[model samples]
Target: MSQELIQAVMVLTKQKGFAPEVIFESLEAALLQAYRKEPHSNPDAYVELNRETGAYKVMAKKQVVETVEFPETEISLLDARKIDKRYEIGDIVEADVTPANFGRSAAHTAKQMLIQRLKEAERSVVYEEYYSREGDIITGVITRVEGKNVYINLGKTEAILPPTEQIATETYHEGDRIKCYIVEVKKTTKGPQIMISRTHPGLLKRLFELEVPEIFEGVVELKSVAREPGMRSKIAVYSRDENIDPVGAC
Candidate 1:
């Protein structure tokens, strides 16, 4: 077991918000990668670590045989018995070979691999959180404008407001703050693609639901909505109880 390696793994796990086991697994893979680069290397090297003590070992599997043709697979029966006494002719033995010969390059590569994997994991988490927020209102600041599309920064992600979704009378510049309704959500190969709109009728309904307590509390229900972008919008409402005035509620 490498105490320094275990400490480093713990630090990295905390920094990346990843579990300690994941970090240890990445370390084991890095050790195997380094071991595979040399001559007389075992192709099938397995490693395991004790979660309590952080003790780890690297072992190679070899078949027990009277005569050895391939040294990598077959080993003399006497050497196999030294590691494990229960070893028979058809049995396999595990030989420990944990050493500190992993080069600086291999260590650096392992660090990069860990960082990249953690980033992908974090992105997946953020995507799952935002995916449930589809067809809802999100506030953002206008970051930049490209041709006709505006990019709005929504904390973790930037949403694209296309020309078709923008209100005609609303002119936006950089640093301007606005709230838009999420019209659609798509998962692209890169990440989540959130299509936001200011002209959508759903935005009006959502706004009324936010402004009125009765609509949100189930006292009044929003039936239908229609909008004319920046001009005007009409929303139909109905109440479950006849005593509740739906129009007055909004």
Candidate 2:
């Protein structure tokens, strides 16, 4: 079972691109929750997992006192000395209390919890990745058209091209490759909601930056752009070097 758990972690790490420590921490938290659900469980208990061996143990913390008042949270100095002679009354002792049947009972619950944690991690990753790309141009394939919204597959995630952001004269269809400017990226319960646009003037500026080397290299500055979506567009440009003609360079 330990080997199987380690194997699953390795597989998920490779497939999901998650750090091993993240998965281990999540699994330990899940197991801790499962252990706490058991009858007469110690409230101060924590699960310690061996990353290399995939072995785990449930440990409960008890403070050493001259007299034991709460058996669950306090241990007599004499008892603490029995475990370790250097133990003092003010010290805390952590004892192993892993149940014999804990592995079997907690496996299912831990697996479910780990899956939920990974999904949340994935959403966070996607949100951060897309958030940094806001205001940039991205190319994607149109996957589907639902009502007035066009869904584009951008490899890692999907983007939405709503009616308000679409070109009025242009029609969208599935399997068509298109480029759109990312207007906004919002974190939602479902995932990152990426709002893209085909009619935005930023799209024209981005296209110019991509196709025009002078604009991209800062030799010619693209001051502003005015667009009519599928109709026509105009741009204002200037160059710092008098030798370079900004209009011709573009």
Candidate 3:
């Protein structure tokens, strides 16, 4: 265990947006997989991390027995006693075989596995974040228009604005900024698909909800809405209290 490694892991935990425990868990799984890839790797091999020091150990758990029928899982009592005098038959013994300290190939294998786990964790963070903001409005730049699909740049990723959701009257061009409501945020094989809409009725409702504080504060209630989207639309409003004029306030 080195103080340098501990500090490095602490910095990585912040950068990767993972807790200390999560990093340790990922490391343990990676180390175990690395150990299994070795020619002499044992199925009973497991890995553990030193939480405070950031040191990890790959260990094979073997049961101490009078006769070692399975060398991978059982160790002779005499051999176990040589390592530790307290060892007796039926006792479990752990063999410390930390790959980094003992071998090169095993260490490389573990490193590759850890990299993959980190990438997947990053994707999960993005998915959960956008999924929470589904059904909300975001302003993005039109990156491209191909056939009936419009691609919008949402900073972190691109969202698709299908033809049905585009405004018929509005002219779209590259780099044009537009406000679109997020109809859905879906996780697909290609990654997150943020479906945005310019013509959905919810867009108008959301706009009013944002602009008019009375609807948000319960001072006025929105009864119903009828829309010819991006053109003609009518929204009915009612005052919760007779003293306040809903239509005038909107």
Q: Which one wins by TM-score: 1 or 2?
A: 2
Worst 10 residues of 1 by lDDT: 97-106
Query: What is the C-alpha lDDT profile of model 1 across 41-154, one tens digit per residue?
Result: 677877666665656666788888999888866788888889778888978887775555544545666567666666666667668767898889999999999999999999
lDDT of 3 at 76: 91
Name the candidate, 2 or 3, with the larger lDDT value: 2
Supply every candidate's count of residue pairs whose N, Cα or C atoms clash at under 3 angstroms.
0, 0, 0
lDDT of each: 0.79, 0.91, 0.80
Error of 1 at 200 (Å): 2.2
Model 3 — TM-score against the truth? 0.81
Better of 1 and 3 by lDDT: 3
Ranking by lDDT: 2, 3, 1
How do all the candidates rank in terms of TM-score, highest first? 2, 3, 1
Q: Give candidate 2 misplaced runs (Cα > 4 Å).
A: none
Per-residue alpha-carbon lDDT of candidate 2 for residues 1-250, written as tens digits (9 for 90 to 100): 7888899899999999889999999999999988987887889899999998899999999899998877777889998888899999789898776777999999998888888888999889888988998989999999999999999998789988999999899989999999999999998889889999999999999889999999999989999999988888999999988999999998
Q: What's model 1's overall lDDT?
A: 0.79
lDDT of 3 at 57: 69
